[model samples]
Target: MINSTIKHLTFITLIIIGFSISFTSCYYDVEQELYPKPIDNGISCDTSTATFSVKIYPLIQSKCNSCHSTAISSGGVSLEGYNNVLSAQQNGSLMGTINHSNGYNAMPQGAGKLSDCEIANLNTWIHAGALNN
Candidate 1:
């Protein structure tokens, strides 16, 4: 039964090899963790076409609208529509509050500040003349 024994040993060896390969091949390689992203590595924020409808409106609706809507008007600020938002911007409170600049209240009060990308988007929009679009 040497032939039978040899076949069994061969099968066992194949199973061992398969398991070794299966176990070893599944290692994950997350490039971001290994290489890491550089902070402010010259990647400018995308502010082109930062329209009110597409970008600014949605951002305010989600973050600030809850408190600043016409119904609530917390702190007497109503960011209900285009005109109100425009007023805030024109009066310097929009950038001041959002930017958390001194002499102005930090908006989204009690929550973490808006992300840098968001502030950059607003800045770009304002720089582009703060149009109704």
Candidate 2:
């Protein structure tokens, strides 16, 4: 009877130990998988090649031309052509509105703001004299 009780207790203790090992082994706190860092696609923001036709005008066409084109001219703003764009940049309204500065309306109305790269490209173009090119 004493030997049988000892064997039973030993079996139960072994089962509990196995269960504890299985549960703890399966439990994982993988920090890398749980909280993944953002992947870098190796793409860098290059504003050095910023140009009116290549960078600025296309961006404006896609973002601003919807409402500020020659046909629509919402809020008395026209961003259709290079001349009109230069005019706006010169008048301080383009950057003011896009930068969402005080006393100026935020542009791309009813939509999200432009990306930092896009804004930086515009700034680079403007600082480069906002030429037709």
Candidate 3:
């Protein structure tokens, strides 16, 4: 009787351990999987060749001009053309605001911040003289 009881308890413990191992192995972290680090995967960013007319202006117009254009400029800032954009950059608001850093208003006020690639491309352009090209 004693031997039979001991064997049953051992079997139950083994089954519990097996179930725990299987459940833990199947567990997944949904957040990490959703927001994995950005990868290139052979798709190029082309920051080196970005230009104002070809690359920068369209992006600015689409993202910034809705609130920052000449017609109804928000915060007294107009990103209508290359010169105005350059002035913003020179005054340090361009990077500060977009980067969501302190001491500057966060841009696209109610919208999501710019993506990393967009910010990197803009940085490349600014570092390359914020040209009118």
Candidate 4:
């Protein structure tokens, strides 16, 4: 009787160990897949024709829209429409904040500063008269 019970318990223990190993091995966190590193294609960024619809709007939408959109408008600033974006640009806050210049609030709140290429693109667009187009 004692030998039978020992054998049964050993079998059950082995089954539980097998199940635990399978379950743990099947699930794993992939750091790279979860948070991918930004890729650099070794090509220079192009901002020659930085139109609002094509370049400026999309950039702002991805980066600034979360905090400055019409629905939320954090800090009483709205970058939803072209007019609102224009206001920020005209007043120099857009450049100041993004550039992390002195006496201006660093933008995107907690995120890293925009890349040099991105900043250059914005500067190019603004210098090109910041047209609605």
Q: How do the residues 1-133 of candidate 2 rate in per-residue lDDT, one tens digit apiece?
A: 9999999999999999999999999998977666654222224567877998788988999999999988999998899999899899989999899989999999888888887778888888888888888
Q: Where does model 2 exceed 4 Å of error? A: 1-43
Model 1, residue 37: distance off in Å is 7.8
Off by over 4 Å in 4: 1-43
Give the per-residue lDDT of model 3 (tens digit) for 25-132: 999888645655432323345576678887788888988999998997899999999899999999999889999999999987888898776777888888899989
Q: Estimate each model's TM-score.
A: 0.69, 0.67, 0.66, 0.66
TM-score leader: 1
lDDT of 4 by residue, 73-121 (tens): 9989999989999999999899989989898999978998887677777
lDDT of each: 0.87, 0.86, 0.85, 0.87
lDDT of 1 at 107: 90
- Stretches of model 3 off by over 4 angstroms after superposition: 1-44
What's model 1's overall lDDT?
0.87
lDDT of model 4 at position 96 = 88
Residue 83 CA error for candidate 2 (Å)? 0.7
The lDDT of model 3 is 0.85
Q: Candidate 4 at 92: error in angstroms?
A: 0.9
Cα RMSD to native, each candidate?
5.1, 8.2, 8.5, 9.7
